[model samples]
Target chain A: MIVSGSGLVEALRAGRFVVTAELGPPRGADTDVVRKKGRALRGWVDAVNITDNQGGFVRLSSLAGSLVLLDEGVDPVMQLTARDRNRIALQSDLVSAAALGVRNVLLLSGDHPSYGDHPDAKPVFDLDSTQMVWTARNLRDHGQLLSGRSLDPPPDLHIGAVENPFAPPVGFRARRLAKKVRAGAEYVQTQLVFDVGAFAGWMAEVRDLGLHERAHIIAGIGPIVSPQALEHMRTKVPGVHVPDAVATRLLRAGTEGFTEEALRVCAESIHRIRAIEGVSGIHLMAFGREHLIPEIVDRSGLDRSRFDMNACGSRERSADAG
Target chain B: MPPPRAVPTRPALSSRTLYRLHRLLEPNGLYRFVARVVERHAWLRRPFTRTEESVKRKVFGCRMCGQCALPVTGYACPMTCPKQLRNGPCGGVLPDGGCEVYPGERCVWLIAVERAEAGGHAGDLERLHRPIDQRQWGESSWINYWQGRDDGLWTEPGGRATPVDLGLPVLVTGKGDRER
Candidate 1:
């Protein structure tokens, strides 16, 4: 039988500290980068998340990118945002992800269209993130769509949603996560985490509400490559909170010392964030710094696991699996 | 927290003017005080309630989710948006301010931002709004405000229902295809 779900799910289920990485597809039609990243990340991460036009910029569809990674023997967590697609398209894509052998799905109320490449293009937020989670739950556990229509075989999908731990009202973030879980999120990938203390507090609340029991909370970590990059994320991203110390360090790095501090920041975040009670894993959304994964892994000093042939993917299990 | 059922506010204050009043009263204790008075009032509530409902629905496309965020949103009403966006505009808003859902019309969030900018309450627009309470539908929001229907109240009510209880079930009334 095929080992279902995704590698990330397996690691979480096993109570292992999970590591997942993001793979953003290029704007053009090319699977080379996707496959390349897949191989580079194969043993390093439990799963790879393909962003759907991240930051409202146009790129290859996550579904197509996921297929490329799937072909390359990488577990791709296809992200479906409500910003561009409506319920029909979203549900259809969810079904297609299973058909295409993609097991993990991350649902988001995508950023507004105005933020993206085609500001002239219309948005289609048919459902918010909460409702999308509910819709997915109805389809998964109930084996029926929100309309009560039955499916021949419910897709073996592992549903996930995004949470901004530091988003205010800070207290409501946990409640939103609870709602997402109740609506059927098996895991949560949060906004970039720089404030570890705030995350620990959020995790405490998640544990208090027993949300951590139901959903695996994976914290998002990223390396600020440049001071400009740091500035953009801090001001433009709605819920992300970038700390001043990181900013000051990055500014002091002054481009020459950039790499060392950036690497340290990413690694230290993983180390500190891993200690949080409810954090089941770390999601490295090293947005533009995919090449730095090796440095991140080295600095974190965390246990690493090689790819399991038994895990779902096209790659056959063998002695040389890693 | 339903009121006496026969009392709704009859302030002779029109909702158009009332929206402006809310903006003014929000900082002071007056908004809550007015809400309490409206909740406790007794008599001729039906006509007043009906007028209030129709006017708000027509002018603002109010879903009346029991939490009125109009004051913070520059009175543009996030609830007026098709997605009922409480936080901010989704990335789907067109450059010309057209609705991604309705199309050919202005995005409520776009209008809200313009209002916020003009009113210099842009920070208020960025403030997070907890999910709306659907159970308060059809009830006078004025009364709900007094009862603290949503978290925007002076003090957040303790022990509210979890998101599991809050993320209501889909009605599936066949509008599923339209949202696409």
Candidate 2:
């Protein structure tokens, strides 16, 4: 039986570290992908984020995918990147997403059109992610639009953001995250935490500034269980700082047993990440290998007490049983 | 690739022309002199102000946030960018120096890099700069420059201060940070 599970906000507010998964919308109008993925992640993830034209390429709209997940009895966080829309469209979509039962929103400065399938498409970053975050909070807390016009009933959204612990001028990342917290981000998922030591240093500053109390810091992880995945992320993904030592570990895992080693490596990172004081939870990207998450989560044993999986009334519905 | 759109070159004498008239006027005391001359007479200042708006709107996508940084930005207005980004290019900048929004034309950041290179002031441009103060919106930035209402640098309208006394904490700008 399907039932409305629990809100991520409740989990975080109650001091339960939360887990969220990202689902990239299909390139075409195939609702099957959304349905299949949504059902798979139903109970296991606290929330599922429907990516909006991620990488600045055209895809099935995030709104459509979000609705699909919502129907599957799994809550969704609509990821809105400010690459193709101006403030007006952004505000409109925010309202629409909330109206459609989306309780969470993740703001992003999307990839350039050149990075996606349609390099010829015009990009619009009318409000960068910071401004977008501020604007979203304004709509939620201030009950107004970018033009300062009032909304009769504002949309309710729990805002989240992304951070890269190793971006250049590393000293200011904590400050930047602080600014985002002040702007309206209630939670932050760092760019994949490949280097646990580096991430711990970044976390030290976050704790120093007392931002962890204000924003739930979720560490990002994905099983790059292959030598090819390691090479691709290190070379292709921007702002992802994969140290040579981590890459070499994966390469030495051997091709036949690489998947197991990769899963172990991810689990090890999770094991190490859970030891960090300020971290609230973990975000598993798990692009093509969603099936590995259950075992990985069980193996890591970080925040394994989210909800019960048997009953929906007194007990929590199964996160994977949908 | 789409054919590049014609970006507006600054007028020969406007505040945005020479490295945005920021550094040039800053060191030479030209900013104070020009500001005083405008404040000297509303009659004289009004017409000159009208011309700056009309001309700048065409040549530079001037949002007139009261802070000018042409000298720092290679004289290409950050306001023209679809994102209106202040610190630097959002990760979306095309490899060809074309804008992510208008791929047919060069991004303002590309132009800023070229100008900064030409002026040899790239190192100095990364200093802690403030976000725009909305009070000066739609006003003449050249006048604001003289009045001292720069990005988050002023306390109120028509305010000026010593750089050492900005009071606001420093925040570094990132190259790939999309929220600049």
Candidate 3:
């Protein structure tokens, strides 16, 4: 009765809204921070996502971080990026993740190396995000490689992809999302959304294109902490625009109440997103403020009953009793 | 000569034809196809090239056009053309026999060495060489060709499959052969 990839899919189909949280590991090789984060959020969130050198900054490998989470009895969503590894290394890590019972995965065409701390580092885009999702799904279903050789047993993985609606050429983003769906993306977690109306418009398009039927679309929500951080996000991060009103509110609130104001905005945004017809869930990227996830979820008025211990325990009991 | 076996007419170009032509103009299709197919089917895609190489040889080697232009001149094109070594070898092969420009496999120059020796033209192997007329075909024309091929128009005479003679010496003008 363990929640497999298929189980997640089934849950989505059954109108059960899924929630996932990000776990940002420390810069060095230490696992204690990741292990602690994983342990804290265990059984609370649907899946604990291990980020891959987030923001193109250096960090422990997502593979290693996910492995630690897996050992800690938490379901891990291994984030695969085309930034660091070629197809060989990417596939190798994916197989390893599957073997270790990490069923869910997020395929990302990570930020360019120029955006990272190591600007000189080479970016290996052997396969983009859409291709990565297709690759994962293919490995899970057909047990084969691109060369058409057969795997002994195909890995079972829940393939997910990232979507950014705020990106320029908005139409291009929509088309790319559709392409990702065609490429076997079973779920899409979008870039952190500040404009609920824009997010809703995107969801409507997803419904129009029949993407909701093919994949579970999850809106990304990042809680703002300070005016400086908000300013940095708007100016620095391409494709991420925090509306002037939200920025004004944060600015007016001053440093004392910035965190509270940010949480409220995130909570309201999540509530609005959840109300959208095609939205299946929310991905809370609290940046380094991982502790704020539960608060955001609570304030968003989301029913955690599906992930509640009693419900999970009963489902297990029923399966066992049957 | 009773109509000389009706030279299998080249298909009229279309979008698909253009893409196929684009693919054909490249060194190898199987590797490209394999790369694409593997992207779509990761479980079946393997890193090792022995099986892939055999597949390429069987399916696309001589059946495809660009392979003939490969420096090896015997085996199928390795499809490992490098950006830096636009001409021939800069004599920078690594100790591992891989190209300094492209790290994984044998240098194109090194492969050409064996090929030149086999072909009894070892002397020609030492001279720096460039690729033969590598022009990107027109997209609209390619699509028309593809459509023609798909619709069986390529087999019919005067249906745009006329063999426009491409005069030879196939020079490697850095500007590419627009004249041809």
Clashes of each: 8, 7, 24
lDDT of 2 by residue, B97-141 (tens): 455556676666556655665577655334333335444555677
**Any residue pairs clashing in model 2, and if so which?**
A43-A319, A44-A319, A123-B101, B19-B70, B19-B71, B20-B70, B20-B71
Clashing pairs in 1: A56-A116, A111-B91, A112-B90, A112-B91, A112-B92, A113-B91, A113-B92, A114-B91
DockQ of 3: 0.02
RMSD to truth, every model: 11.1, 8.9, 18.1
DockQ of each: 0.08, 0.11, 0.02
Model 2 misplaced stretches (Cα beyond 4 Å): A1-5, A303-305, A312-322, B1-84, B87-140, B144-180
For model 2 chain B, give the 10-residue run with minimal summed lDDT. Answer: B157-166
The better candidate by lDDT, 1 or 2, is: 2
Ranking by DockQ: 2, 1, 3
Local accuracy of candidate 1 as per-residue lDDT tens digits, A158-254: 8898887765445445765665675568899888888888888889989998888888888898888887778877756655677787788788888
Model 2, backbone clash pairs (residues 3+ apart or across chains), number: 7
List, in the given order, the native-contact fraction of each candidate: 0.05, 0.07, 0.00
lDDT of 1: 0.68
Q: Which candidate number would show the highest lDDT if scored against the true structure?
A: 2
CAPRI quality level assigned to candidate 1 from its DockQ score: incorrect
lDDT of 1 by residue, B53-92 (tens): 7776665666555567776666776666655666555434
TM-score for chain A in each prediction? 0.92, 0.93, 0.92
